[model samples]
Target: MRRSVLVAVMAIVSTVAAGCSSDPTDPAPTTSAASASPSGKPTDISFLVYGAPAEVKAYRSMVKQYDVDHPGVKVHLVEVSSADAALRRLRKGEVPDVFLMSRRDLGEIVDAGINQPIDELLDSRGVDFTDLYKRDSIRAFSHSDRLECMPYGISPMVMYYNTNLVDFSEMAEAGLDVPKNHATWTFDQFAEAARFGARRGAKGVYVDPSLSGLAPFVYSGGGSLFDDDRDPKRLDLASDGSLEALTTSLELLRKGAITPTPRELRSTSALDLFKAGKLAMMAGFRTLTPELRRTPGLSFDVMPMPALPDDRTLGDASGLCISAKAVNTSAAADFVVHAIGKDAVSDVAAAGYMVPANTEVAESDAFLQQDRMPAHAYVFNRSVKDIVTLPLIESWPALERAVHGDVYQLFYSRVIDIEALTKKIDEESKAVLSPPKASVTPSPSASASGKN
Candidate 1:
């Protein structure tokens, strides 16, 4: 359901965008002016990245290569585990020349007003936007016609099923064939499969209590989390289609189809449960592919998450942003371009840790080839067009927490009342979206005058 943004969980930067061109054909990269120092003067620029030790090491290695190409520039590598932490560093006046982060963090970053628009910088460097590998990736990171960041990954949610546990036998018995492909599965058919598998003693599904997990369900039911995406004051979770979707999902838990109720799985992860062979199916992003590959004796494969007729899959992206306050803006811009360049993308794709934002790397045989279980590695890329972008708003984090918190409370309590729960969530969300009261207890002079 929800992919952990944490470095260790998926070994990917949190967030993703819609999929791009089906054609993986490599194209010539945009020519950018070299980071040649006219004076041949040495410069030190800071680069901030998130993830585990391995990711940090890999970035350092990549930077070393960049240094060789641009001898006058030196990159000081800084590591942090999450976006909030990076923002904290920025608040403390430790702004990096460039920093890699999730697109979801853009709202907060914009609020902090520390990032510079990349258009002027890109133009100055002669990097044609069209020449970039993934056009959709770039579009996903842009807001209000402003190119705020350069994308690095296009992570989309997909379904992972334990081949050994899913009810293939029951499918045959019921004269119901298992979906031949990701696109073939429907919500009704999916439910039938889950019900059949549950009867055969398999736990049907489990999802995290996060926006990523809930968004698909809402969209499938012809509802959205926001009433009006452009208006930060509008959150529309408690409604018709979303209500129906929420009801159906909760009923599965009540019927013992989905295991480890939200409360029960407080500490245990859905991924761990699936890897241990206890789950029949669960939803996750592409990074799950690598983790599932490394686990022993797990016969797992991925498919697109089953959806209703109107549903669109959720996709988010993350990339690099230059600090508006960066002292070495030119060098920072050059470093970001180099980091997501074609060669870097090839290495990233080969590692199988993430789907590269570069179209060439993502579509290339190296990324498409599967020595791993999910023979349908292309599902992530193929599902790009169907992606539903979460609204960009400063209050998104608050709204997400509000929605998830109330939903889980209802799920664990076995309330099974969709209308009531939705109403409650709607009420709470309204409070978040509403402007704060002015808190006027009369001016101090007025108060004194009135008292007298």
Candidate 2:
């Protein structure tokens, strides 16, 4: 009875899964493929995608163009608000033929048995893995000695500062040290800038109250996120290097006079505050660019995360995956190959949010729109060299959730015990990272006492 109820809920969710379309004048989407073409029967395959409206529009445009370029292949686009939502559909057995997924989530998706190994399929489609995509990105999607997905976007975390609030020219005039190179700065310089920006009712900066938000700084200071990189048993935030990094970062990040107050943050997000010019800076990936561009009166530019003597940052890599349950595997493979090709990736890159894994597109005007707000767009391309990708672990999402509150407290709480807090965080993480083994059940024959 419970199973039937779940099926009914999923059926309803599937009906509305076509999501928003790029063009309002376009006809309503059909769950199935369009009627057979005159020349031959068309193969219908559904694709699941998620991103901002503009990014989604870019994908919709890509699908429209793909249909025009390849006859007798109809690609249905499925839009969801987030990766979690897409995973929900897959977990409910509503797997689409093809989907876009984050490399970090590869372990979870693979464990769920929804995604298929696509190395052979991609090779069959003539994809030049070495020449086409970024090397680290390709390695990010490999699991169990096979490529699980085709690398799409490889975005590293960068500092987005309001030019008006954190003026380099003003800093130099005031005798504060400015970066000799605009692409890089030191942690001490970053602190000075934050203090400089904290003036005239504007806060200096805001890093997200999560592990992902703090990772770049930790790693830049020569710290590790896990006790074991290959098979992490617990978080390593309490280790010597990691603790030192966090201690240094929190000194600046936790300054009440230079950051948003808890009450203010509860009322409005750091991103919204930054958009309103009430905040000086924040750390984000390429996806923040499009929305920031849309905000009026906001002048912003990108820079590498402040180096702790070493240039290091976190990365977000996404890829295209084919469903193990897909009926039209060949059709899906064709679409995946075409989607990552130069033209399709360029269309998406033009949207101003993606740092394409495609080598050509990464270096093209499509990504580095020289005319755009971020004059130093090359920072993104350069920062890729310093990205420290998190290890693929099935319980990553859960681990993050378990320690989120502690991480937030470590960043925002007054009078925090750094050592105690980090130790507690490591302990909490183990519950998710290395859960206890389940007890074995005894056989009935072994347990029997000759009594029924």
Candidate 2 runs further than 4 Å off: 1-40, 441-444, 449-452
Each candidate: what lDDT?
0.67, 0.82
Candidate 1, residue 167: the lDDT equals 51
Off by over 4 Å in 1: 1-41, 124-128, 131-136, 167-174, 199-201, 262-268, 440-452
Q: Give lDDT: candidate 2, residue 224.
A: 91
Compared to the true structure, candidate 2 yields what TM-score? 0.88
Residue range 263-378, candidate 2, lDDT tens digits:
99999999999999999999999999989999999999988999987899988888899999897777787778678877789999999988998878999999999998888888
Tell me how candidate 1 scores on lDDT: 0.67
Q: Give the TM-score of candidate 1.
A: 0.84
- How far is 436's C-alpha from truth in model 2 (Å)? 1.0
Q: State which candidate has the highest TM-score.
A: 2
